[model samples]
Target: SQKTNIKALLASDAIGSTVTVRGWVRTKRESKNVAFIALNDGSTIHNLQVVADTAKFDENTLRNVTTGACICAVGLLVESAGSGQRVEIQAESIEIYGVSDPEKYPLQPKEHSLEFLREIAHLRPRTNTFGAILRIRHALAYAIHKYFNDNGFYYLHSPIITGADAEGAGEMFRVTTLDAKNPPLDETGSVDFKQDFFGRKTNLTVSGQLQGELGAMALSKVYTFGPTFRAENSNTARHLAEFWMIEPEVAFNDLDDNMELAEDFLKYLINYALTHCADDLAFLDARFRKEEDKKKKEERAELGLLDRLNFVVANPFERLTYTEAVEILIKSKPAQKKQFQYEVNWGTDLQSEHERYLVEKHFKKPVILTNYPTHIKAFYMKQNEDGKTVRAMDVLFPGIGEIIGGSQREENYEKLMARVKEVGIHEEEIWWYLETRKYGTAPHAGFGLGFERLVLFVTGMGNIRDVIPFPRTPQNADF
Candidate 1:
């Protein structure tokens, strides 16, 4: 029979039966006459303990069974006499597939800082913290697709390279294969973009919302789950040069409908993690508490990991206009005491401090702030009749400031084009996008959720880079 994964073997009820398990050695201990190896296969957090009598194995084989080594252990499944585990393996025979040098292996049977683990990202998955985070990340992703599909949303694949700038932020990574030292210049002194590979300038997509809207126009509801790039030279804990985004666009949906969908979708994802990733979550929860214990007592979280997630799914998100939020913040102790770094203002963008205050301190729950100032939002957001704000909304979680940002799109062709032009976007570049509104365009809305931020919130990871396997930040693209 084939070797069983450690996760299955640990959960198996077939005690006294023979089984073979293949995994990496997390830890090994020698008790003079017997050896115990903690083996993990990446299927689950718990390791299957394999007890081997020293007399049954050769000296060379026992010596090679060190941390980070790969091995195959054929043993009898027996009830564990240990305190932590229910079952373990009584080794009949052991095969050392690969030996890891104790001095060469960066990972050992010790606690390592997140910063050190990032330096060795290729081997970080073997760590308990990262393993739990990745498992939870997978569960969240599965829940995202399942929720959208069950609701009849078509999965749309947006182009990785695009000419359109969805956010109009002008912070995009250009994709060009033009020779830097050679020819290819127009009559003007500037390099000719027309002579480039795409026959024009092109770059990595900043967002898939624009293409998602195109799909939604036909499919009624569509979603895009893929990588998005930004060229912003920010080194914040929250910013990433390249990260995955989940953007869902729905036609014939108003701002309220969009809010409802976002709330439901977020709840579904959190609930799914709670149900499917219980063990991983529990491990991460304890890990979070250990980290929190180092902080000041006043800085501790009010709710634990599972409680926070359950609170989000069980309770309704508090909804209010951005203007109203500003009014509340202006009168807040932080503002009144002048403790806020950014002063509370009616028209300016809300900073992370302000967002966290609203969700964590003021509301003490998830908040959905709507009707952001038009000048701060993207051009696609529907402008209000008062010409001051847009139908934009941002869903702020307790720990994560802004988990989702979405809005009702401008269906009016003339208004959208005027805004596009006012924003200095080349009119000819997005003629196809404009044509959608020119044709039979219906009211629509969508929002984007940063996938890594969700993982950070769920796993209680402090840094965005810690949750992602290979983080691409400013000046850091290490594998």
Candidate 2:
């Protein structure tokens, strides 16, 4: 008989039917007459209990079926006598594919810390915590594609390596084929990129929005979901050297339309998690509460994980302009009491603390702040009539300050070029982007949702690294 996954077997009603199951051993307990083997195949959080009669199997084989060992069991599925699970397997024969020495297996049966698991990322998936997280991550990715496809958006494949700095941050991982020791150099003593593989300087792309906009211009609606890199040296829990970004560009969308799209898109994802990933969400919610309990009384979340997710989906995000948000923050208790580490100032970028104050303390829900200062925003954002602010928007979540950042793109060629010059970005570097405005520009808007950040919020994982499989941080890139 073909092998049945633990997830299917757990939900199955085929009592008394013989089934073959293959998975890594989670745990094994022995009595004089019988032994119980807990097995998991990464299909679900729950493990299948395989009841084995010690008299029927070889003693050596049974001894080898320790934790982390891979085994195949031929058994009869029956209603479990245990309380936690519905069904279990009565093993007739056991075949060991691989044996893990009990003395050497690092993952002994116990609650392991998230930091310790990060060190052994290769085996962390076998754990319930990571298994649930990865499953939800897959579900969210599926929902993202499904939602976009259902809403008439084409998935665009943007290049990973590019020459232009889309965000104008100038922090990029340079891609080159030249010898690092001593290579081509110009008379100016600068390492000449003209002789490089691409014949010009290039780096790993920071965002696909610039290329995504090109697709949107033609396709009317397009989104790019791919890996992006940043060369920032910051080693904070929130920042990653490499991460995934979901950027959607829509033609003829203004700031309000952009805000609406962002709000609806976020709610859809959170709702999908609540509906399709209930088991995983329940597990994570318990984990989230434990973490919450560790915090100081004042710092604990007002709503639990599920409550927070439901609140976002059921309520409309409070919308305000950047100027208005600054005013609120200025008069707020945190700012007045000098609690905020960064001072709240007009015409300046809002830090994560300020954003959290607005979303968590003031609004008590998701908030969308719009019309940010032009100098503080990207050059692509549409310039407003006030001349001080651009048609930019950022969606702030309860725990995560800014989950999504987007704006109505600047459609006027002259204005865009002026901003480009003002920002000191060479016209030749983004000549193609500028040409789009000159020829057939329409009011288009888009936003980037950090894929890991979304997963962190959904999984209620504290560190951004915990959500991603193999995180690339400042000095670490282990498997």
Candidate 3:
């Protein structure tokens, strides 16, 4: 018989059928006459109870079936007598594929902290918490693709290595083939990038927005979902050396259209998770509550995970301008009481604390803040008629402040070139991007959603590193 996945088996009613199930043992409980083995194959969060008669299997083989052991059990499918699950396997034959020594194996049948799990990330997927997170991650990825395909969006593959800095952050991981010890230098005594692999200076792309814009100019509507890199030295829970970004660009769309699209897209994704990943979400919700319970009374969340998600999906996000948000923040209790870490000002960027106050305390719902100061926003954002603000928008969630950030791109060629020069970027660097405005440039807008941040919010995982597999951080790249 072919091997049946545990997820399919649990949802089916094939009673009295002999079947084969392959998985690693989660736990083994033995009695005088029978042994109950909880087995999981990383399908669903639940485990299948395999009843093995002690008399039917060799003692040595059973001894090897400890926790984390890989095994194949041929059994008869029957209704489970247990309380938690509906169906179970009655093992008629057992085969041990791999043995895990209980004394040395890192993962035991107990609760392990997230910090410890990071140390052994290679085997952390076997844990229920990580398994549920990974499953939800897959579901969210699928929902993103499905939603885009259904809404007439083409997935554009942007280049991994780029010459122009999209965000103008100047924090990029250098991509070069020059020798670090003794490399080529020009007459100016500077490292010559002309001798590099690409024959010019290049680095891992920081954002696909610029390349994605090129696609949108021709394709009318396009999105790029790919990995991006940064070389920042921060080791915060929210920061990562490598991350994935989802950027959607549309021609002839203004700031209002961009806001509408972001709101609808986010709602669809959250609702999709609530519908298709109910089981995993339930597990994560329970876990989220437990973690929240450990915090101080004042620091605890106002709503549970499921409640927060439901609220965001059911209601509309509050919309306001950056000026309004700053005014509100300055008058808020946190600001008046001097509790905020950073001061709220008109021209300065809003910090995470300020954003959370607007979403969690002020609006009490998701918010879409628009019309940010031009000095605080990117050069590509359309300059407002006021000459102080740009048509930029940031979608803020309850726990996560800014889940999405975008703007209406500057369509006027003269204005764009002026901003480019004002930001100290040479015209030769992004000549192609500048040309898009010169020739038949229609109003275009787009936003970027950090794929890891979305996963972190959906899975209710606190740390950004926990959501992505094999997290790349400063000085830590171990598998």
Q: Top model by lDDT, which number?
A: 2
What clash count goes with each model? 0, 0, 0
Question: Where does model 2 exceed 4 Å of error?
Answer: 334-336
Model 3 lDDT vs. the true structure? 0.91
Poorest lDDT segment (10 consecutive residues) of candidate 2: 333-342
Residue pairs clashing in model 1 are none
In candidate 2, which residue pairs get closer than 3 Å at backbone N, Cα or C atoms, i.e. clash?
Answer: none
Overlapping backbone residue pairs in candidate 1 total: 0
Report how far residue 34 has shifted in candidate 3, in Å: 1.3
Pairs of colliding residues, candidate 3: none
Per-residue lDDT tens digits for candidate 3, residues 1-479, read 64789999999889989989999999999999999999999999999999999999899988999999999999899999889999999999999999999988999899999999999999999999999999988888898899999999999999999898899889899888999999899999999889999999999999999989999999999999999998989897777899988899999999999999999999999899999889999999999999999999977889999998998889989999999998998888743438788877899999988898888877899999999999888899999999999999999887777889999999999999889999899788899999998788899999999888899888888999899989999999999
The alpha-carbon RMSD values of the candidates against the true structure, listed in the order shown, are 1.1, 1.0, 1.0
lDDT of 2: 0.92
How far residue 255's Cα lies from its native spot in candidate 1, in Å, is 0.4
Residue 133 deviation, candidate 1, in Å? 0.6
Cα lDDT computed for each candidate against the true fold: 0.91, 0.92, 0.91
After best superposition, candidate 1 residue 160: deviation in angstroms? 0.4
Local accuracy of candidate 2 as per-residue lDDT tens digits, 13-57: 899899999999999999999999999999999999999999999
